[model samples]
Target: MRESQPRESGAQAILEKYDRESQFRLNLGKWGLIVTFLGVYLTVFHLYTGYFGVLPSQKQGAIHLGTALGLIFLLFPAKKGMQKHQKTVPWYDIILAFLAMYISYHKVIFLDSILQSRITGYHPFDMILSIVGILLVLEATRRTVGLPIVIVAGITILYTIFGKYIPTQLLSHPGFSIDRIATNLWYQESGVFGTPIQISSKFIFLFLFFGVMLVHTRIGAFFNDLAFSLTGRYTGGTAKAAVSASALQGMVSGSSVGNTVASGSFTIPMMKKAGFKPEFAAATEASASTGGQIMPPLMGAAAFIMMEYLGVDFSTIMLAALVPAMLYFTGIFIGTHFEAKKRGIVGLPKEALPNFKKLMLRNGYMLLPLIVIVGTIMIGFTPQRAAIIGIVSAYLISLIRKESRLSLKQTIYVLEEGARVALPVIAAVATAGIIAGVVSITGLGAKFATGIIALSGGILPFALMLTMVACIILGMGLPTTANYVVTATVAAPALINTFGLEPIAVHMFVFYFGIVADITPPVCLAAYAGAGIAKANPFRTGLNAVKLAIAAFIIPYIFIYDPILLLVDVTIPHFVLAVVTAFLGMLAVSSAMIGFFVSNSRIWERVLLMLGGLLMIHPEVYSNVAGFLLMAIVWLLQRNRKNGEVSQSAAV
Candidate 1:
């Protein structure tokens, strides 16, 4: 297939614009600095309220409005004559800035008194203020993200009013009055200020701030060096290094496309140098980078949303994600290995790989921030506190070396950059909150779950398959975090209530499928991003990524079926058996996908391996034994083929 050059260049230009602008060129630092400080203040205020629950509803709405407005002032393009230009803030920006501060101050100081009387008459000034605030938020939404999401939010608002007239089984509601809808969406916690926004302010922002600190401390470079030291001398080593480094970066980056572009620039070129085709190299990096969302420690903002929705601890969610994440990356690593072997490509020169001992001696302290984060969380510190500590540790560790130390100016840059990256995420979460609020207020969540259950005929596997399809479809268009939020609220509950799966397992199932959408067709943004770098066919790169990540597509279903793999409802013996079986199953799946195991595989062997993999994934002891036997037979056939080759040579 021919690559579409127009789409590739358009995407490249967008990414380059963001990357270049992130550096604050053309004297935009002053506005960047002001907007960034507002972002920090907003984040801190939300965190405080989240921990103490002191803020009233009207005040919360005001803060939300102010933050949304500031984000707009920071991100929106200004009109310069005939052309729309991206430039520094103008005078109107300062006006908007002061307005934001005034809104926040008014809410913090005066809104509490107004809320004291339940029967207080509606003041004309209050009504006007509220309408203006809502309009500002809508405009901010349009400027920060594209128009599609704003349109979706508008439809949801319309649905809240006109939904009663719609005739459908899945759509049933008595509808709400405009005042009630506005009150619920604007003045209450259920709509714009819902759990999505709460999670963003409290957890996502802190972690995002932590990621920025780590980047400033040179931890990103440290990960790259460590990945090179570990894997750069193996077959398809550069690709493997990309996979490993991306996995580490994913834990912190919270973005699949950003992580792909960041890691792919270095790894894709190296893979190409090692004889990998540009498209395949791009696809490999794309697939691996997308998996980072599923990796543990910090599986994007979705993990926090899951924890909030499930009322589970962060550690439990992280623990459950370990095996699935490992399997996803293992699949990518194995696929890269076999591809290199098939093409007879060699590894990088030994001298090219980083010297592990020397590198560690110089930059070992960079790892301490992550260690502190994990240790603090495990010891029962709140994730917020742990994140604060992590950020501090990142800065302190950077001081160990003069080159890595962050100057005050550099620190401000990190703060501003973090805010810039966080703006869209905050918007996404806040907008999603409205959807969730509507679902909750209308009991649409239960109705949606019930409908899916009935459609699946109450069968677990069929229901899971339907859920996976739904998640992928949603993920294709939405960000991973938003996708997970929507899926978990609507579909995950069905799995738990109808199928009796553990809550953690159900949420994780939805989360995995949501992330896999990045590599799926139609809207595979990660693969498309990679194709831009490789100058490859976007669809073909996406197809290769799907093939390479086959195990990710299957492993979630495995854990869903045999909950023991998730470390739920299991004895020690069962846990061991499940792990061993799942490990072997992943190997079979990888081998089948790669079409190589000791030698080139025939169609029959590939079929057998696939069946063996599926069988091993099932919980039945009989299936396990059968899968082991099938694998043994394949091993013997390959050995016999090798011996027959030697015998033929001797006879000749």
Candidate 2:
């Protein structure tokens, strides 16, 4: 579990290069003290609100946005090269930071009077502030989150201003007056303070704090140790262990690239040492780490957003996500097993693996924090309450062992880290809220949905395909939070309205593709980060990641068609059948993708495995029967071929 300082530094450097969220000022000297105090204050503010009570929606959001904006401007440089090594905050950034805070506080101070007046028009003062506020948000977003979302928001604003001039009926609307636009985008809950930021401020921040506490308590190491113990002696054990550990870490870890660098720094080297190709080693970790965003408990903080968008309870969304997540990891695990078999790679030495029984017994208490979070939510506590308890439980549990315990200084640092980590999310969601606000005022969601249906010729499968592409493309550039918000805002409506699908299914479908975008080609940040660690080709790693994570691409389509795979309104027998068959389906598909099964598959066999896998996964009795028969046929043929080869060798 111990890593050299240089390895940790290498991982940090990689994280900073690819993951914008990790690229922040180190707060040298006096600036360090200032950043530290601000970080602690941010965390404490959220914890205090969660424990006592939150302010009104607008006020709470204003505080959250204001604090986050200030921190982001101070912590992240205007340009990557402008603040090399994060030496100090520039004077201009300091002024911009204060301006951003003033913009947010403008809402908090005048909210009562504005609501009391119930005026539809913007005052001159509010109007100017609104314009400045929007600009400040975009600037902070560019500093912390990147430009894709900022561009999207800018387009929405421009559309709002000029929509009346558009010749196309479907795409155009009567543009709002500048006054109305300013009021709606700033003063109302629909814009910067909309559901996205509401959820971010209220729920996401607490869960993020819980994740930080988990790291402080060394639970990440525990997960790695536990995974190595369970899988390190099996075939392609190191790679499999990476899958297991990354999933565990990704549950709370959230950022696919971040998780990749964190665990890949440990697992990728071992995988290379174990004789797996560098690309495959990196791909395995990248694919597995990406799946963590879809896993339950936290789900990269997407579950809360889904809860709001779907208007469903937290448990429903979390439960629905389970089977698909399992199938995703299964695909990766099976692919790794076959790859190891094909390469004739053996497992790690048993003596080198940790003893599963003893390790669990010693550190079993570490799991209670997660258990506390899930258990409380299931038992009817709010997510905010559950997260607060989870954070406290992590600290309490850490005190059980001297090595796991955090000192007062470390505890404060954990708080600081929690707040610092949340800055990018805050910026992304608030900017995305502007996009969502535009969609609302312009009635673009409905129009966009209609356009999608018309474009797809009213075919559900075709619409799903279109939506999938949109999600991945948007995901490539957006942070997970912003990606989900944008896709769920625009793309999800297409599927939900056109097909009358389960809202959860529609949302989960978009959610899955968004997370996998991290591994999709051309701009696959997660794969790029993994390749950096493994010293492999980034594009090849992305292709391998897409291959290894084939189930993620396939599962969304299946769930949309079957809904059984998503565990919506299914009987016990049917649910069990769906899961088992789906698992078998993954086996076939994974083997086909890897070009290996039971002693290496022939090309035609690979084709059949794929066809049969898809058929079996369809959840129809007839298809399952035919698919199973095909899989059996291939299994028997491969087995016979292997035996014949052995006999021929013996005769020779």
Best by TM-score: 2
Pairs clashing in candidate 2?
none
TM-score of each candidate structure, all chains considered together: 0.90, 0.97
Cα-lDDT of candidate 2: 0.88
lDDT of 1: 0.75
lDDT on C-alpha atoms for all candidate structures:
0.75, 0.88
Q: Which regions of candidate 1 are displaced past 4 Å?
A: 1-33, 36-65, 78-84, 90-110, 113-139, 646-652
Please give the RMSD of candidate 2 to the true structure: 2.3
Worst 10 residues of 1 by lDDT: 18-27
- Mark the regions of model 2 whose C-alpha exceeds 4 Å error after superposition: 1-7, 117-120
Candidate 2 to truth, TM: 0.97
Residue range 1-652, candidate 1, lDDT tens digits? 1011133444445354323222222334356556657656655564465456535444564565466567555545432121123355577766765665465455557665545522564455554544454555555555554455567667877887888898985776888876566545654567766788777766777788788788877788889999999998888888889999999998888677878888887788788888988888988988988888888787788899888888878887778888778878888888888788777887788897899999988778778998998898888988878777887788888888899888877765666566666776776776677677777777878888888888889888788899999999877766777778778878888789887888888888889888988889877878888888877888988898998888779888888777776667879998888878877877777778778766678999988988988788777899999998887788789879978998999999
Compute the lDDT of residue 435 as modeled in candidate 2: 93
